[model samples]
Target chain A: MGLTRTSLTAEIGRGANYTDKHDCVVALAGNPNVGKSTVFNALTGMHQHTGNWSGKTVGTAFGRYTYDERTYSVVDLPGTYSLLTHSKEEDAAKDFLVNETPHLTVVVSDAACLERNLNLVLQILEVTPKVLLCVNLIDEAKKRHIKIDIGKLKKHLGIPVIAITARSKKDIERLKEEITRATDNPSESAYTVQYDDEIEKAITTLREGGVGTRFEALRLLDGTPEAGGDSVPSGAADAVAALQIARTAAELSDEIAKALVKTAEFIAKEVVFVEKATDMRREKIDRVLTGRIFAYPVMLLLLLLIFWITIVGANYPSSFLSNLFSSFEMPICRFLQRLGVPQFFTEMLVFGMYRVLYWVVSVMLPPMAIFFPLFTLLEDVGYLPRIAYNLDRCFHKCSTCGKQALTMCMGFGCNAAGVVGCRIIDSPRERLIAILTNNFVPCNGRFPLLIAMTSMFFISADTAASSFWGAAFLAAIIIFSVMITLFVSSLLSKTLLRGVPSSFTLELPPYRRPQILSVLVRSLLDRTIFVLGRAVAVAAPAGIVIWLLANINVGDASLFAHLTDLLNPLGKIMGMDGVILLAFILGFPANETVIPIMMMGYMAEGTIKGYESLSALKTLLEANGWTWVTALTVVLFSLMHWPCSTTLWTIKKESGSLKWTAVAFLLPTVIGAITCILVNFVFGFTL
Target chain B: MISLSYTPMCALSPGECGTVSDITLGGAMRRRLQDIGLIPGTSVRCVGVSPLGDPRAYEIRGAVIALRNDDAEAVHITR
Candidate 1:
C-alpha cells in the first residue's frame, strides 16, 4: 500500500525526464541476444537477469549507476530487431526513444554479427541523435577472428563507437566516460540513410529536422497503420496530401527497408573484415541435434534425464526442510503464549499460516531450485530454439505458431510465466490458444505432488529401481498432458480462436558455452524465489482459511465436513471423494498447498502438511478409498484443472478480456472432469 | 554456359547455397526479411533441416534463421 522500492524505481523508469534532478536517464537499446543485458547487468551491479537466447528481457528493467559523481538511472529496453517493426519489444523500444528522449541512449551491438546488429543502430540514430554505439561481445568476435575497424566505423556512423567486451571492468569504465561525453554533447548529425531519388525528393517536400525529421516523412509514406500493421499513427492523410506521392505505402516501406539493408551492408563491407566465421562448430552440434535419427531421441532423453535428476535430488532437501520447519513450531507457539498473546491467535498463526507456508516452500523450493537451473542451462546452450524448430511442425498442425513450443517450455517452470511468454507469439489467436492450453503442462508446483502420488501408488517400494520407475511415470504423465495440450490447442484453433498458423522468423542463434555461474544465480532468483514468493503469498491466507474452515462448527460437524459432504456426489462421479475435490478448489490459491490441504481434510489436523512417511500417507488415502483408479484420476485432474489464482490473474491482464480468462479457466476444468469420469468408467468395467 | 536455375528457398536441401532472386511474401514478414539483409543479391545457405523437413535453417549475413515452409516457399533463389 505504501511506496515500495520497486514501485519507486518503476516511476523513474516510466519515461520520466530527470534533467532537473541529479539523475540522468541512460537507456540501453539493442537487438535480441546481443549482450545488451550483459552490459546492463555489469553497469548496474550483478543481480539483474541475463540469458543466452532472445526475448529474455521482456520488460524494461530499471537500475541505477553513477559515474563522475553523477547518478544515472539505467533503463534496459526490450531487445528488438528494429524500431520500425510492430513487435511488442520493438514498439517499446521505439516508444521509449521517441517519447522519452532520454539524456543519453546507448546502442549495444554484437561484434560478431555486426551487420545484422547495425540494422538496429541506424534505426535508433534516426529516432534520437544522442546515441552512443557500444559494440559489445568483442571476446566472441575475437574467437571467430572477425575484425572491425573502429575508426572507419566511427567515420561511417558519425557517432562515438566503442568496441569492448561487456565483462571487462576497464571497458565499463571507458563506457562510463563516454556516457559523460555523449550526454553533454548530442553532437554531429548521424549518418542519414539515402533512399531512392523519388523518396528523398518526397522527404524534401515534407518538413525536415526538429519535430518533423526525414525519418518522420519516410514513416508517413511507409508506416501507415493499415500497411503490415506498422505504426506511423493514423494521421498520415494530411502528410499524404502534402507529398502527392503516387506509390503505395507498402512499396515506399519496402524501398526504405531495402535502402536500410543496403546501407548496413555497404558500411559492413567497408569496415568489417572476416577471415571466415567458423560457425562450423555450431553446425556440427546441430547435425546431431537436428539429425533425423537422433533428434527426437535426444529431446526425450534430456527430458527424462532432467526429471530423474529432479525427482532423486529434491527428495532429501524437501524432507529436511519439512522436518526443520516442524521442529521450530512448538517453540514458536510457546514463545507466543509466554508473551501473553491470545491462545486462539497463537494457535492459528503457528498451526494455520506457518504450516501452509512451510509446506509450499519446502515442497516447491527444492524441485524448482534444481529444475529451473537445468532448464535455463538448456536455454543458455541455445537449445530452446531448436526445440521450437523440431516441434514447429506439430504445433503448425494444430494451427498455431511454432513459438508456442517455447511458451510450453516456460510452462514447465511456471504457467504464469508461460502465459506471459506467449507475448512472443505474434498472432493474437495463436497467443490466446497458447495461454489457454498452457495449464495442461504441469508446472513445478504440481511436480512435487505428481512425484509424491507416483511414489505412493505407482511405485511398489522405495528403492533405486522404484524411483527410476517413478521418474519414468512422472515423465509419462507430462507426455500425456502435452498431448492433451496439443489436442485442446487444435480444438480451440478450429472453433473459438480460429485462424491459420502464423509465420514467424525464428533465429537459431549460435550455441555459446553456458555461463554456469550466471545461469544458476539467475534461475535461482528469477524462477525459484519468484515462484516461491507467490506460493507463500497465497499459502499464508490459504492456511488461515483452511484452519478456520476446519475449526468453525456448523451444527454437529465442522464447516469443512459439511462442505465436503455437500460436494461428495459431484466428486464421486469423478472417482474422487468430496475432500479431494475440495482440496483442488482450496488449492486455487497455490498448487503447492493442495496436498497439504487434502491431508488436513482427511486426518482433520493430525500429521498434516508434514507427513511422517509414505506409508502414513498411503493409509490416510486408502482409508479414503484410494485405489489405482483414484490415484490416476487425481493425477489427471491435477494435470488438467483450472490454473492457480496467479496464472488466472496473469491471463486476465495479458488477454485484457474477462471472457478469455474464464475460457482459460473452464476449458481445462471441463476436460479434467470428463477425463476423470472416463477413467473411473473404464475401471468400473474392468475391476 | 549453365543457365541460372531458380527454386523456392524451401527446395534447397541441407548444405545447398543460393542467392535470393525474389521475395513474394506479403505484409510484415516481407519487410522483416528485407530488413534483415535478405535482399535480391544476398547469399544464403541451407545449413540444417529440422527432423520433419518442414522448417529449414538458413544462414544469412552471418546469422542463422529458421523459416517454416510457408514463409520460405515465398522466396525464390538461384544457386
Candidate 2:
C-alpha cells in the first residue's frame, strides 16, 4: 500500500518551507555523512544542524535560497547510498524524484571517497537528467591526501560538477550559479549503466512500449514493483507482471547491480585519484573504542561522564532559573491582584498556571540544554553509531533493529523526538516496536524527578559525595530503564510484532573534529528550545486543570484529594501514595509538571508550589509521610509509566493508528504498574 | 585467483580481510548490502568485534560498517 496521506502530510509539515511559495524547487540528494545538510544550510542560510551519522536526516528538510533574484526552494532529501533500497529514506529520496519532479536534483558526494559515492550519483542520473554533481568536503579530502579531477569528471559525466568544501562555504556562490544554470537549462549526461543482455533487452522493450523510462523499467525489474505506479495500464501491468516473473526466475537484479557497480567503478577510476594515503586515524580510534575488552567499559564511562556533566553543570543554571522565575511569581501575582482581579482568579492564573510553567522551564531547560548538546557533540564526532554498533547485538537479541538504540538515545532528549526518530528504522513493524518502547528511556523531563528522588532518598547529605552518589544512582536508574526497554522489546517482538531482527548497513562514519559552536546552537535551538516550547505549551493548560482540581471540593475534601483517595489503595500497593498517582494522571501533559502537581496536592492549596532545593522538596515529602520505599517506588514508576502526552501524540502521528497509540500508551503503563507492584511487594517484605 | 570455496563473512576473525563472493540473501537485505558497496568482488576487512562478540565492524570501501553474525553469515566471502 502507498503511504497514508496523513503521514505524508506530517512528514512534509516537519520540513522547513518558505511561506508556501517558491520560484523553483531543487532537490538535494547524497550519501549519508557527506555534508549534504551543510551545503543545504549554507545555501539556504537555515540552521538545520548536520548530524554526523547515517540516516540522521530521516525526513525531508526544505530551505529557500535566493539566486539571481529568484527564490529556489531546496529540499534536503534523506541521505541514502542508493535509492534502490526499500528503506524509508531511499523511498523518500526516490519518490520525490519521481513524483515531485523538482526543477533540479543536486547530488552531493563526499570528495574523500568519491568512488563509493559515485554509485548513488549514477543511480540518480538514471532517474533524472536534470542533475548536478556536487563534490563536497574537498578540504577533508585534501587533508587525507586525496584529489579529484573535477574538470575531467564533469567532462566524463557530461554534467556540471562543482567541487566545494561545505564547511568553509567554499565555492558556494559557484554552486548557486550552477543551480540557476542547470535548472533553467536541464541537460542529460552520457552516464548510463549497461546491464547484461537479458536485463538490457527487457529494459529496451519496456521503454519502447512506453511502460516507463529505461531507469524506471530497470527499477521495476530489480524487484521494486512500487516503482511501476506511473505506468499501470492493464497492458502495462500485464507486461510488468510478466517481466517481474521472468526477472525473478532469472535472478537478474544481481547482474544489473553488478553492471551499475562496474560503471561506477569505471567512472570513479577515470575521475578520482588518491595520493600518499596515510594511516587512517579513525581506524586507530575504532580499535580502542570498539575493541572487545575496552568497549563496554569505555561506553559506560562515557555515559557516566555525560550524566556527570549534565548533573553538575545543570545545577547552577537550574537554580538560577528557578530563583529568577520564582522571584517573579510574587510580583506577577501582586500585579494581577492590583489590576482588580479577584484573589482566587489571581491565584489560579499566577500560582497554578504560571508557577508550573516556570517550574517546568527551570527544571527541564538546564538539563536538556546541557544534555542535548553533549549528545549532539557525540553524534557530530561520529560516536553515536559506535554506541549503536555496541548495542546492535543486544537489540538483535530482542528481535528489533539496532537503530532503536539511536532512537532510545534521542528519547533521552525527548520521547516525542525519539518517536519521530523511529522513521530511521525501515521496517514498519520494527519502527512500531521502537515507538512503543521509546518511553521506557527516561527523557530530560523525567531526569529532574529521577535526580531529585535519588538525591532525597539515597544521597541525603548535601556533600560532593552526595552529588556523586546521586548521579551514580541516576545512571543506575537509566540503565534499569534500558534493561526494561530490551525486555519489553523482546516480549513485544515475540508476541505482537513478530519478526527476526533485520540487518542494515550501520555506517561508522569517519570521526571529524566537531564544530562546537554549531553543536551548541543546534542543540539549544533544535532540541532544547523546541522541547521546552512543547512542555510549556502543554504545561499551561495542565496548570489551570491542577488548580481547579485542588480548588473544587466535593464536600470536605477537594476533588484532587478525592481522586487521590480513589487511587490511594493502588498507590499503596505500588508503594506510592494517592497524591502521587493523581499527580501522574494530571501530569499526563508534561512529565516536568508531575512533581509540582504532587507538591500542590500535598499542600491542599489551590496553587502549585516551588521549592528552592531538593532538600526542601524532600522535607515537604517527609511531612507527607514519604519513606525510602516511597522514593524507590516513585523512581521506578516514573521510569516505567505511560509516556507524556507529547510522546503519545507523536506516537499517534507516527503510527497513524489509534490502536497502536493505545498499545504504546498501555504497554508502558501496564509494565510500570506491574514493576511498581513487584518492587513494592519485595521492599515491603524486606524493609 | 578465483577461489572456488566461499566462507561466510562471520567466519573471518577480527582483522582478517576477504572479498565478497556472493550474497545469499534477497529483498531489502540484499539491496542494502549492495547499496553500502558490499557487492561481489569488493574487499571487506573485519576491523573489530563488539564486547558482546556478535555484531562486528568491517572496513569496506574506506567506511566501517557493523553487521551482526546473522547478517554476516548471509555474505559469502573468499579470503
Docking class of 2: medium
Classified by CAPRI criteria, candidate 1 counts as medium
Q: Provide interface RMSD per model, one decimal.
A: 1.0, 1.5
lDDT for A482 in candidate 1 is: 79
Least well predicted 10-residue stretch by lDDT in candidate 1 chain A: A1-10
Write down the RMSD of candidate 2 (Cα, Å).
3.5
What is the C-alpha lDDT profile of model 1 across A211-233, one tens digit per residue?
A: 25565666666745435533433
Position A313, candidate 2: lDDT:
93
TM-score per prediction, in order, is 0.93, 0.93
Candidate 1 Cα outliers beyond 4 Å, as residue runs: A1-12, A15-22, A208-211, A223-245, A461-465, B1-5
- The global C-alpha lDDT for each of the candidates, from Candidate 1 onward, is 0.82, 0.81
